[model samples]
Target chain A: MAAHMTNAHRRFLQVLMSNRITEGSEARKLHQHCCETDKVYYAHDKLDDFISTINSHLQPLFMQIRKGISEDDGRAHYAVVNLAETEVTKMASDYTEMELELFRKTMDLIILSENGFASSTDILNLADQLKTKKMKKKEAEQVLKVFVEDKWLSEKNGEYTLHTRCIIEMEQYILSYYQDLAKKCNLCHSLAIQSQVCESCGIGMHLPCARKYFRGQTEPRCPKCNEFWSCDTPGVNRMGSQT
Target chain B: GKEKANELHSEMSAFDSTAFAEDLLTFMGINRTEVEETNDSEDVPADFLPSHAWQKMGEEALKYFRRAPTFHYMMGSFKSESPVRKQRIE
Candidate 1:
């Protein structure tokens, strides 16, 4: 209990409670809005400090405001993470045991895949094999949509992968669960799921990181092995029009 | 007739409106505490609105929200359960 915990902090936390996760820019706007509404001191650069104040109060409650990056866009994000793992089903309480089982299996597919994504056809194939309770393909399809709407998974072109919110919230769990199999981005040094691997050394860098690092270079080289970067640098062609 | 009229007058005196109003307000859980609080403030006029009740309610609600697990932790917990139990078919 910091003496400075004010209504502004409470209001900001209340909004975050409903949202669960927020991108950096939206969070900054929220910070300003909360302070203005509560008539508290506001500083654009002090958002992190303000969050820390709220986090301190939440520490005893086994919660934290964690910062992570968007794997696809390389932008910052903040999410509320729960550190406690009691016997109770604390996450997604609204989901049934069968749905959770499907989710876990889906995670297996995505994390183990070389591309960090699992096609819907493959995930839907898991619907019948769920050991908790076999689900009809139709029911499983609806559940997948709910998971996407809840921000746990993102889908594109029939491919499904962990959403940015999931990465930010689950980075530690994934890192520990997969251990050596989970490679960190060579440039940013955070866990990189959707990343291009170095052919020579086997280190990984996020596509965005690779794009930024290799920008304006005549030839892209691996940051780790200094070998020729084999993978197509994502968004390389669009760089010309913007620059 | 005089004795009946006297009994009616006594019954009417017993049922004071001010006292009855106070009792009704107290049973509804209003007025008492706020009246006492506002009594000390001569400049500010007293009204019936509850003070700090919403702030207290918000704090109580937030207590539950703060304890909720993030999605990863929930999934991890589910994963740690007995594989034998989870393998049961419907």
Candidate 2:
């Protein structure tokens, strides 16, 4: 028993030492990159760009660490930390890209619906419908407000009318946002009922869930798939039995 | 005996008056201001108020304003007098 305890202690110390070394190396590299670039790489205003740059450079290093750690009976602690951080970084990047794309698409939808702005009421009604279907109230409100603001609908004397441009804009934006949201849901390992397909990525998911995750009410990444989603899509339905 | 009785009567009369005054104040509901004044003078500590009081106050204020007459008018409803019914001459 004494010998076994000693062996275990030695193994623990070895693992700890290896982890410290790995962490030290990663920290050094990040520091060097920051110094060489002189551009505050990690703390830059453009988070998406920074995240992508880091991932592209650091992914291989993380894989190598993982390979080394997995070889030992006692998994290397630093390797796990590195893997988790990388996943988190990837998710963050994906979410930012999705959000930018959603905004761009929403703007385009507004421009297209500029003429038939009278249909804003219909869109609002649709928003209400979404709410009744268990879509988050705030999410529904935001999407509806975006449509109204885009001039797809005109409000006069407390009545809403859909603008011609609004219709086209709504259609295009909704289709794209819905599709991308779905794809994000899939990436996050969500089991939300698929609603729409992204023209760009061919993904689907519940709109309410997407909204919840985007608003920071829930974890920013999908719990299952760990994928990042754009915050712009309201009413994203998350998969799995919600506790 | 008469002197002692008079002193006791005087004391009872003063007590009755004080009780009557207190009852009158209560009936008139005029003691609320006095109570409020006393409370103000006591200087409650900042933490004495319930933690959620500010949030509740804000919500209540919002609800109150939402039900105000001007709010209804601003929401596009016209304030108009009802039409009078015509009565036949008896």
Candidate 3:
């Protein structure tokens, strides 16, 4: 039995050293390719064969281990086997934890934005976008906390408002959300705060400001209206007065 | 409970020689001492239970130790090669 176990272990080590383990997308592609080339063999069969080859090598050892249980003393045998199994499980859990930590560190280095805020939503979106990406939820949360601390995006009054300087730097991002609200009357340089949006272009304006900018013309145009312009058109001067 | 105990005992008795050796050692209350004892008469040292128990216990311990590597392999616990590959995108 001992000799059989040694042979199994040695075979396993040989297979490992030879890099015979199937892994990743490449393995999947290979399986697909093999399946396509050989009608008799399916991709799943190849995978099963790979697993069984490794299993066969180890079966002898398992048999030997089971052989150590005596019928006369059932309780003691079960206890020993159970203890050994528990030890193995504990070792596996420790290894999984270490692997998870390493994955988190790698993601932290790669996914953080320049300003240091790792948005949880962004990370989740990124994971969704990248099928090959692997990250645990706990690790993602940790990365987000680090990003918030570094980027200074702490919440105040239940809102994630940036610090003053960051707000200035993030002007474009802030403006994007409020672009529809920016309107001015054609006549007045002051910001237009109210009125029906112009039919020609979608823009709300203060009624007086619109009349003043149009020079008392019957067809009053919105000063800051983007009717003829798409949002992306550059160099189009805004009509609204600077606040 | 009595029926369950009987069932368990019967199940245990069905175990092979390797299991018998282990059981004998446990019954004798000798922990790992039998593992190092050789087959020689001096090694048997009559003070212990009969020589057969010593022989059987030694054989069982050795078998169990030898099987350790195989058991580790079967579970993929000791196998370094993971079926899943780490992907690197350039």
Candidate 4:
């Protein structure tokens, strides 16, 4: 199907199919290329045609992003198509024991506290919390080191938050025990039923809805949750399942 | 309460937050340069927050999260989201 698309149209589709939600500067790029008949918006007309065609093909996967969450810090957010969420339901054993422990620590912190990101200080302090076979502050730091290196969690601007990969991959584990999923998507009105669920607060929008929300803006967020809609569509992630 | 504090403090020497990030940088093969670190200062005017210092260090260590680990994922379809004890198609 991509064979027929002009180079401009293909480029737009490549960015659109990205696992990451269309938001922030990425949102601007999409709109710039899809709208504005001027040469600045590369495949303007062709992108329109492509979205219309591919939107329905991937609808079951919530490929269209029509909504967004805006945060208090002043940033736009868009939920992307979490293509891996439904494939596996648990943290697969592919991780080493130490890796698993770090993942658990993040989960504990997030679930125990109503807040989303786990401050690095609090996590390192876990060494203090441990009474037995304790991780030296060095060991504790090592644990976090492994986590950051592995993409289980992400650190940005001095805060550590569970990556969307971990959140969506571990949604069952994260939400099943704690956190209520009461918020609903304004665009689709669906229960934010899938990976479109918010990381900070439980809210979401279909991928297409999120993309559309970013149709022209630099950063469009989920108005209800106020989170910078983000996803890492860098490569394939087989994800976890029950042991 | 006293016991908890002791347990946590006992770990002070074990978890040097700064050292941890520096070491992690090496482990991840990030090009790292040594910076002079000083820990000895003596002048008794009391406005020190030890926890804050540690907290700040913890935040500093988090910048490397973007270079997270990569995994080689395999592709295969699972039969179900739950385990079933039924007959096999094999």
Please rank every candidate by lDDT, starting with the best: 1, 4, 3, 2
* lDDT tens digits by residue: candidate 2, A99-135: 3233233333333342212233343344333212433
Q: Per-residue lDDT of A1-243 in model 4, one digit per residue for the tens?
A: 333434444344455444343445565566565444334334433534545444454456533433333321224543333334343513344454444454566656654443445677787777655433456677777777766665456777656766543443344333443435322345655323222545666555544455555554444555677666554211212123112
Q: Output the number of the DockQ-best candidate.
A: 1
- Give model 4 RMSD, 1 decimal: 19.6
lDDT of each: 0.79, 0.35, 0.36, 0.47
Residue A172 CA displacement from its true place in model 1, Å = 0.8
In model 4 chain A, where is the ten-residue run with the lowest total lDDT?
A: A233-242
Model 2: residues >4 Å from true position, as ranges?
Answer: A1-55, A58-125, A131-139, A142-243, B1-38, B41-45, B48-90
TM-scores for chain B, in order?
Answer: 0.26, 0.21, 0.23, 0.23
Can you give the DockQ of every candidate in the order shown? 0.05, 0.01, 0.02, 0.02
Higher-ranked by TM-score: 1 or 3: 1
Point out the worst 10-residue segment of candidate 3 chain A by lDDT. A71-80
Ranking by TM-score: 1, 4, 2, 3
Which digits, one per residue and each the tens of the lDDT, describe model 1 over residues B1-90?
987788688566676789887765454445433445437668654545366555655665777775643233343446345433222133
* TM-score-better candidate, 2 vs 3: 2
